[model samples]
Target: MTLQKVNLQEKFNLFQEQWRPKIVGELNGQHVKLAKLQGPFVWHHHENEDELFLVVKGRLCMELQGQEPIWLEPGEFLVVPRGVEHRPVADEEVHLLLFEPAGTLNTGNVQGERTVENLERI
Candidate 1:
């Protein structure tokens, strides 16, 4: 078993593909995913689960249904409540860590661009 505290940053570097998330670790039923994002992602939402996003390196813009949206940096995080439509945009290459369920789709509610079907790590 793994006994050391996992460094999310190192795990994120294992994958060089954008939007493709790697299952790094798990905590409290939440699957920790490390992904590098660029460009804009499809607009979607999770109908039954809240998604947590933490920027590990760059900046990200997350637009929610009825809110002003949030811009997160390295130490910033945003918990997108369940059932809310949101879109993520990255002006530059960004490294991020996500907290959601194991089966939760990266695209969430609707499937289109940026949807990763099968995820495998390096």
Candidate 2:
């Protein structure tokens, strides 16, 4: 395989869909994905895996069950523990980098309009 560098801004420019995560790279059974998010997302939890969300641009709000919401700015990241109920909200367009198992669903336990099973690679 040929090794190559990934440019975040360039990768993000390829798609305009919101809530859809595009795979950028993979390693050790995990996928590195990039996505654009806006509005409130459904509440859900991963049954067997933790999810890492890194804010690459704009703001991201992580609402946790039984706790105050956490806000993330560019260069910040949050790891949602497995089985913990949480929802992500973004008032404006937010760019995100996600690190999780290759088969991890965008909507986790709940199958909804936002669930993306077959992720596209950028």
Candidate 3:
């Protein structure tokens, strides 16, 4: 198969819905994705892996239980420790680079509106 060079815009274009992640690439044993998020999400955590979120545009906030929420701006990134419960709240539409395993659900253990069982590609 011929190799394809997909850019950020191409990946961004693939995102058509909110809180859904589209896999873009893979590094080592992890999958790299682009997700568009807005509004508040349920508190959850990855039981077996650390998840990293890097804001590509707009503000993204991570609220930890009983702790100050962490705000990520464009060019900023945060790695939430594995098994640490956290909720994500976005004031406006935000684009992000999500690094996690291939089967990782964006909302983790929460089975709600935001969970995409079959993660799409953007």
| Local accuracy by lDDT, each model | 0.86, 0.96, 0.86
- Candidate 1 collision pairs: none
Query: Compared with the true structure, what per-residue lDDT tens digits does model 3 show for residues 1-122?
Result: 67888688777975568887888988688999888889998899888889999999899999998899899999999999889999989999999898987788777778887778987665
- Residue range 8-80, candidate 2, lDDT tens digits: 9999999999999999999999999999999999999999989999999999999999999999999999999
Task: Tell me each candidate's TM-score.
Answer: 0.90, 0.98, 0.91
In the range 1-122, model 1's lDDT, one tens digit per residue, is 75877777567656688989888877777788888999988889888989999999999999877889789999899998898899999999999888898788998878776788887743
Arrange candidates, best lDDT first. Answer: 2, 3, 1
**Clash statistics: count for each candidate:** 0, 0, 0
- How far off is residue 84 in model 2, in Å? 0.6
- Runs in model 3 lying further than 4 Å from the true structure: 1-3
Which is better, 1 or 2, measured by lDDT?
2
Q: Pick the candidate with the highest TM-score.
A: 2
Worst 10 residues of 1 by lDDT: 6-15
Q: How many residue pairs in model 2 have overlapping backbones? A: 0
Q: Which ten residues in a row have the lowest lDDT in candidate 2?
A: 105-114
